[model samples]
Every structure is written in structure tokens, then in C-alpha cells.
Target: MKGLMVKDLRLLFSQKKTWLMYIMLCLMMSFSMQGAFIVGYTVMLAGVIGISTISYDQADNGMPFLLTLPTDRKGYVREKYLLCLLMEACGAAVGIILCEVTSLVKNGSGVPADDIRSAVVVIPVMLILVSFMAPINLKYGAEKARLVMMIAYGIIGAITASAVVLMQDIMPDLGHSALVKIKVFFDETLGGTYFWTVPVVLTVLSLAVMYVSYRISVRIVSNKEY
Candidate 1:
């Protein structure tokens, strides 16, 4: 796992422009929104940048060589997910520090507790996104998987909008169903006390999804001729 992580980190840092772009983006975004949203965006950026390592390894027929090393297919997938988690941690940490500093400069104080709580949850959310994506990315290279994910998200959003708009007319109180739960969750996490449970629940859910995704990825890798 250590070697695999080192390899991906080396490949990831090889793209200096990506790091610079993220740096500039965070700096620019800091002025436009609060610290929590900035951290959320950074978390998503980490997920995208981390998954690109798979595409990098696929380039020039690199996977075969990587598998020939002292790592198996399952190990490779595990390391990829672990590497993504590491990237998320690093990105979130950087975002928190930057946000705190920016908040201090702007308001003469550090980031608020609400902002910190929201920022922490972004890591688990990004983990869920990466977990769902890594298998699709491994099965079909990054470019195609990216298009698929975009389309998938678009369709889901459209359906959700249609459901919320149309179902309310039929049920009249449909909005009170799921939205209430979400509102309560958000209120507790941001407004009320016990915000820490949000991260704990999200981390558990994310790990469950990642474990299922890992099993699927292993099957895909084992069945394919590499």
C-alpha cells in the first residue's frame, strides 16, 4: 500500500499545472464564498485529481507493468481508494488552513465552528463520489467514465426536479417527506448541536459504499485479461 501510494503521489505531483490551478482556484474562490463551500469544492477537486491517476497508469500500457510488480489486482484497487482518501485529507486540510487564514484577514477571526463542521463532512461526501466513480473509471478509462458520470448526474437531477415539482401536486404534502428529514439533518449539523454525528454517519455510509465498489472492482480486474 505504501509503495502504491508513493507511485500515485509521484504521478499526481508530476502534473504541476494541476496543483497551481487548484491553488489559484482556492485563492480566487475564497473571496466569493464562505470557508465551508470552499472546502467542499476543494474536496471535489481532490476526488477528480485522484481518479486521474488510474488514467495515467493506463497510459502507455502501464497497468500490466504495475500488476507485474509485487501487488495484486485487489491490492491495486485498495491502494487507489486509499490514495484518494489521502488526497482528500490533504486537500481538506489545506482548504481549512487557507479558509481560516482568509477568514482571519477578512473578519479579524478564524473560521466559525459551523464552517469547520461543514468542511469536515465534505471529505466523506467526496469519498462517496470517488467510491462510486473509481470502478466505472477502471472499467472504462477516465474520459468516457467522466462523460457517463456527467450524464448520469444530469438525468438524476432532472428526474429529481420533475418529481419534486409534479409529485407535490399529486400528494400535496410530499415535500414534507424527505425534505423534512434532510432539513432536520442539516439543522442539527449546522444550527443545532451534535454536528459530529454527521461526519460519523457519512463516514460509515461512505465506507460501506466503497467496500461494495471495491468488490466490484476486484471482480472486474480479475475477470479482465489486463
Candidate 2:
């Protein structure tokens, strides 16, 4: 398992595309003038880059070659998931540092503690997104899985929008006050001192998801004729 993970890391580091994505992330970080913008970009980039890593294997027909080695199917799948989570952590770290530096230079201090707190909320959400998508990618390959994930995301967006619209209709008196209240709740509860727990829970959940995904991928691949 360790050898397989090392090999995957080697392949990831040696790839031009990987470096290109990193460069793009760095450039984006440099241009982000606000902490909110930085956080948004970081979360978005992490998802895109992580999904691309999975797609690269499918696109390049690397899976068959990887399977031919002594590595087991579970090890292969687990390694990819682990690598993606590591990439997310790295991206988050870079983004936080960039935001701090930019804020210090432009405003004498980086984004406020509250803004930083709010940004931390995205960490678990991103992990949930990745965890949900990883098994789909492993089971269906990149293209099909992407299509399914897009549909899923669309449905989720629609549901959320509908809920918001319905709430507005039901509580005309509240106007946007409800949203303000919800935001305050999130800011004070989820984004406050409890924020640190998000990463810890996300890490644990992601590992659990990876384990399950690994088992499923192993079962699928082991039955294949290749």
C-alpha cells in the first residue's frame, strides 16, 4: 500500500498538469483582494483540481497499467482518495497564508477573525463534495460520473433555491431578515469556536468514505476482465 501510494505521489508530482494547476491556484491567490474572494476561490479550485486528478487516470488509461502492478485494487483507490484530500489540505493552507499576507499588505491586517471563521465552514462542505464524488468516479469512470455529479449538484441547488423562495413566501414579514438571522447563526455557531471541529469531523468522515469507496472500487475492478 505504501509503495502504491508513493508511486501515485510520484506520478502526481511529475505531471505538468499538476504543476499548472498549482501555478493557476497561486496566481488566483495573488489576485484575490478580499478574504471572502480568496476563500471562495480556494474551495472552488480544490474541487476542480481534485476531480481532475481522478479524471486524469481514466483519460490516460492509467488505471489498467496501475492495476497490472502488484498493487491491489483497494490500495489504488484508497491512495487516490488520500492524495486528493492531501491536495485539499495543501490548497487550503496556501489560500489562508495568501489571504493573511495580502490583508497585511493592503489593510495592515488580513481579513477579520469573523471572516476567517466563516471561511473555515467551507472545509467540511468541500470534503463532503469530494467524498460523494469519489465513489461515483470509481464506479462509473470520469465522464459518466461527472454527468451524474452535475445532475446531483443541480438538484441540490434547485432544492435550496426552492426552500429559500418558499420561506420568503411564507414569511413575507421577515423579508431578508431570516437570511440575516441564519447567517448570524452560522457565523456564531458553525463558524465560531466550533469551526475547528469541522475539519476534524471532515477528516474522519472523509477517511470513512475513502474506506468504503476503496472497498467498492476493489470489488468492481477485481471482477473486471482486464
Q: Which candidate tops lDDT?
A: 1
Q: What is the lDDT of residue 171 in candidate 2?
A: 88
Write model 1 residue lDDT over 38-110, tens digit each, in one string. Answer: 8888778888888889999888888888999888888998898888888888788878877887888889998
TM-score, every prediction: 0.89, 0.77
Which residue pairs in candidate 2 have backbone atoms (N, alpha carbon, C) closer than 3 angstroms, thus clashing?
A: none
Q: Candidate 1 overall Cα lDDT vs. reference?
A: 0.83
The count of backbone overlaps in candidate 2 is 0
Write model 2 residue lDDT over 2-85, tens digit each, in one string: 876676566567889867876776666666556645764676576657666667777768878777788777667667677777
| Candidate 2, residue 140: lDDT | 83
